[model samples]
Target chain A: MSEEKRIKVLLAKLGVEVHWRGVITVAGMLRDAGMEVVYIGNAFPPEIIETAIQEGVDVIGVSTLGGNHLTLGGELLELAKQKGVKDSMVFVIGGVFPPYDIPKLKDVGFDGIFGPGATQEEIVGFIKDAVSKKLGK
Target chain B: MSEEKTTKQILQEAEEKRKAERVPLYNPEALKQIKEKFDQWYNTKLREEDRKNWFVTPQTILGSEIPRGLLYTPLDVADLDYMQDIGFSGDEPYTRGIHPNMYRGRLFTVRQLAGFGGPEDTNERIKFLLAHGATGINIVFDLPTIQMYDSDDPMARGQVGWCGVAMDTVKDWEILFDGIPIDKISVSLVTHYPTNTAILFAMYLVMAERRGIPWDKLIGTVQNDIIMEEVVRSGAEYLPPKWVFKNQCDNIEFIRKNVPRWNFITYNGYNLREAGTSGVTEMAVAFTNAIDTLKELTGRGHDVDWICERLAFFWDPSMDFFEEVCRLRAARRLWYKIMKHQFNAKSPRSMWMRCHVQTSGISLTREEPLNNIVRAAYEALAAVLGGAQSMHVDSYDEAYSVPTEAAALVSVRTQQIIQAETGVTEVVDPLGGSFYVEWLTNEIEGRILDEIDEMQRLGGIVKVIETGWIHKKIADYAYKEQRKIEEGIIKIAGLNYFRAADVKLPEIDVFRYPEGVEERQRKKLQKIREERDNKEVQARLDELTRAARRGEPIIEYCIECARAMCTEGEMFKALKEAWGTWRPPAYW
Candidate 1:
């Protein structure tokens, strides 16, 4: 079999109101795992991530801590669909999100959800596992 | 590094300039007098006379803690030079003051920070402040407008009209400036996170142009303090640093070409200070961030002279009187030294520290709220003595909510009292000759230089920020300060000390969001989308994307996107695709 493709992940803190610590940590972890990664800056909303995904990113991750997660996050997932990559690229949500909000977030079509107190290793392992399972490698 | 050039050369330069009066020794009599006063102040309430102790404690930022005190003495600053190190105002090493005649028979611009609900709401407040002795207006835009999102955007729901005024187009800006004179008053628009600031300024300019207002004659400062935005908010996640830096460069270039007289960014340490940082971190981080931006601007083919003059600083004045004074003095001196020694900035104005000071918003406590008036009064006086070019005193009741009209008026009166009642305006740099003041100045200057060196050793402020150095520092400092207050060690009057029994606080009146503010803003943005040439907006956004791909000036394209009603998030996303996100370091 051909060598397995190392999944590429780009992380961002989507929306205009949130800070970006969690997303950055996750991005660093992804990079350390030999995943080609791109980081969009903070306060970036959905459209930016969707556009970045058009560059052939295998997964798009967003971290948010502000109050507009439901609205901004929903819009981001919608933009992903609008950009025609809802299934092609996995989308993840992370930040001060509570564990209870994971179902709601997942229902909104976010591929994965990581909340407060999540370590970088956990996020990287999950992304790697999810991408690996999807690629059948 | 030679002793000869340090002492002899400095003395010769002083003698050549007819400034040599004596060996630069600390005057024994002055030191004694300063110590006597300091002892008296420290011992006034102490149980024992021997309890009087003086020491320089370093206060930390978000991540560190250093205790500071009320006074600093000549003993603390014995190694500092008056002529060579402190230097003359308007000269190299501007420690004493930035300009030769700082406070030049002119008061710091009394900018009233006012904006809320909508443009009309802001207009009324602007009129109110200007009528009440406010020499200028500092417009604070709401999160919706600041982030370049239309009020109707799902992301902007409920957030509309919460922080400040919401504006979506040229029409909104026109209404905001309705009767305000662009030429007469110095307007400073406070904005951070330019994902939308440049476009907003462009929209304001478009309206100004439509009104036949000369763009060159229109003066105002657009605060593009993007570096400290992450720290100001609730440490949430956002874009990567690379994109933030790119956007700042685009704004610098855009302002250079279109709004030549306008200040593109006012590297804001004050915002972080308001978010609760110590005086040293305030200056260190502000300067560090400014240097990062300056280096990038210069690297992007922008001349230091052209960009430096348009550059400005925004710092906060804390309650610590002497420390605050030293902060300003140290800031000026450090800016001068850095511009000359590091960047080779030759222009006098470029080296001068032209800053705007706002009384600490974070310091205004929600308890014993009226006491905030006292806090603001002292802070404003510190800014005046510190030779701030512009200042805004926080409303006494700002901690609870938006300042009531009475509270805002008291804020204005606080500044007026210092300007008119206090004999401080009669002489410039009134505390210039104080040995204690000079000592504190050197202490702060020394500490700031060390901080800059540390940041430089970390590769730069942007690198340190990426490494989460600044963020961690600020967080640690915040946590320590909170613990101190909680432990009753650093007693806050209302919170810790002076407990009162069922105290009924006075009802403070302030601005309220207008009824249906969200609906009105949403409709306004909708109208903008419907009326604006949809074809033009698309063409502009495409052009903006193309410019970003080419690493061209993205600001003009951003303005075009703004005109097209492309939300702030939309404009930023287009750029994000090209520049990629900022990957914060994993140190935090």
Candidate 2:
């Protein structure tokens, strides 16, 4: 109980979207960085929240490329609030999000927002620090 | 004469044997001299000098790990047959081009994939581009349409009109091409899957029929390939490869018989390549699919020549400049060989490898977006130099959304500038005789053949797909490429490397979907249900179900349903009931 546990990250792809290389690459990088990662594919907002609660994952990463960020990301946050998992988990969203959508997604309650051209070190480091803070490490 | 063998007689017999075996392009003695010279140069310049460790292994941008030599010369292509291999353009084994005078005869069609918001919005963009001198029309459907979900479906929420036109019924198809001179302006419907192609393309056909346009008079292409549905663009509920191929063949069978001028199927190497396979694997997969299509079509009692005459290819020309050029060249030559030698196809037109090229969108970066313009231009130039029949240049802003209007115009103008200003199209295959190109062309052909053999060994490409082997292979290559980029082995400007801080990136406008698109589309679907012959549509749906169960081509039934105002989802649902849905092997 006194020691830190390996950060459990759950990566969920929103909707039946294609062009998922970004998410898959992130998953691999996280796994290699000694994180327990469960990738649930083609999920909706409610399912993603339910899975996070069930899996008790420290971080919830939602990747979408279908330009449904504002709509679906907001829906995920709304559902996470109703499910009351908003504080227990860290949320990050990455995809083909434009520069303008960054502040909007941040306002939608995502802790981390990544657009295209995000590096492995940046994403990984951000997740590690966020998860550590969530665990009060 | 051989019994009393004079030296000349013996030499003549040896020459005859060599002729049967197809001797090298250069004399053996000459090649030996060239090899010695090459070795001498390599030794003196590198090994003998202080830069002894200067030899760096060369690889492609996509990293098939196909080694590249320092230089290619006549020695590399010593065995190439001039008359047999690099024949004149329009001849057998068309390494030069399908047409002798390529662009000089008919300039390549400049088409951009345009669709977003509603059908009317896309129609307006198509008109704008055409007014700006775009030669043809190409349209893409929104996620719901491509995924075969109606606008009102729960799974389709938040996605309607998000990226492409929100098409659901024949009404959308009708509105999409409202006044665009259908017969004259060749339209490419990116109906990316067999199931969707059957519905969307059927709606298109019905619309044309309503307008009194004969299907035979229309010219366009339908993306009716099986790989897109089963492999490249996979979903959990896609129909199994076994039945999906049937839907694909049915569409092609009907199209070849009815719309003879239209390309029935474009074996989409673009989607497959964009899924993150190497450039070489792209051709291997496409030609493999084409070979399977040829077999299935011929098995349906269609003549091989008739089936192949309108067959086409779609390629994603990435940043591998020379390899992209060589790949297209090798693909053309290999296709001709497969037609002539393997299938015994009779018509020369049937053997032609007509392809459309779109510069690789996966190669674009969101950071410092202007660099993408140069990347796209060079890729487009590769396609043009490689002799694509039609071309599309990816916009610099595509990493974000379906390109904005300004970006779309730039893409169209990119092709125009290539066609008008570059002067690269004046002659056919100017790189045809270059030592590097010819040597790489032959090398790529051999490697591609080896790859095809590998596919055959794995029980053919179709079995490979049905077994989920292709997905695994793609993932492996994709991961490898990602690692390469991450490790700085492959330098993507403004992304992995060259993060030039001093260069000011211009503020680019991103495309936004029109408001209430989903509401408007749903209203139209509701209105159609209220207005159309509902009983007739249900009856046609039953016909479609029976057609699917009876192993008949369902395109006819789909056309009937489209004419009856049935929606794409209705047809898709009917087929799902008849043929059943399938889940692919979970790689994650």
RMSD, one per candidate, in order:
10.0, 5.5
Q: What is the C-alpha lDDT of each candidate?
A: 0.69, 0.83
Winner by DockQ: 2
TM-score of each: 0.75, 0.94
Per-prediction DockQ scores?
0.08, 0.58
Over B1-588, each residue of candidate 2 has an lDDT whose tens digit, in order, gives: 124332223324544555776745788888899899877887776654434434344444564565666666887788788777788988877999999898999999998888888898988989898999998988888887898988877788888897788888878887888889989989999998888898888999999998899999899998988889988864547787888887788888889889889888999989888877987888898887787777778876878998888889999998878888888899898888777666678999988999999998888987788788999999999888888999889999988777888998899888889889989999999999899899888878877777776676676656888888888788778777877878888888777676776645357898876789989988998999999999999999999999999988888999999999998889989999898877777664
Top TM-score: which candidate number?
2
- Which digits, one per residue and each the tens of the lDDT, describe model 1 over residues A1-137? 24467778777665655444345446556765688887655544555665575667888887665434566678777877887777777778875442334578888898787653344566777887777676444
10 residues in a row with least lDDT, candidate 2 chain B:
B1-10
Candidate 1 true-interface contact recovery: 0.13
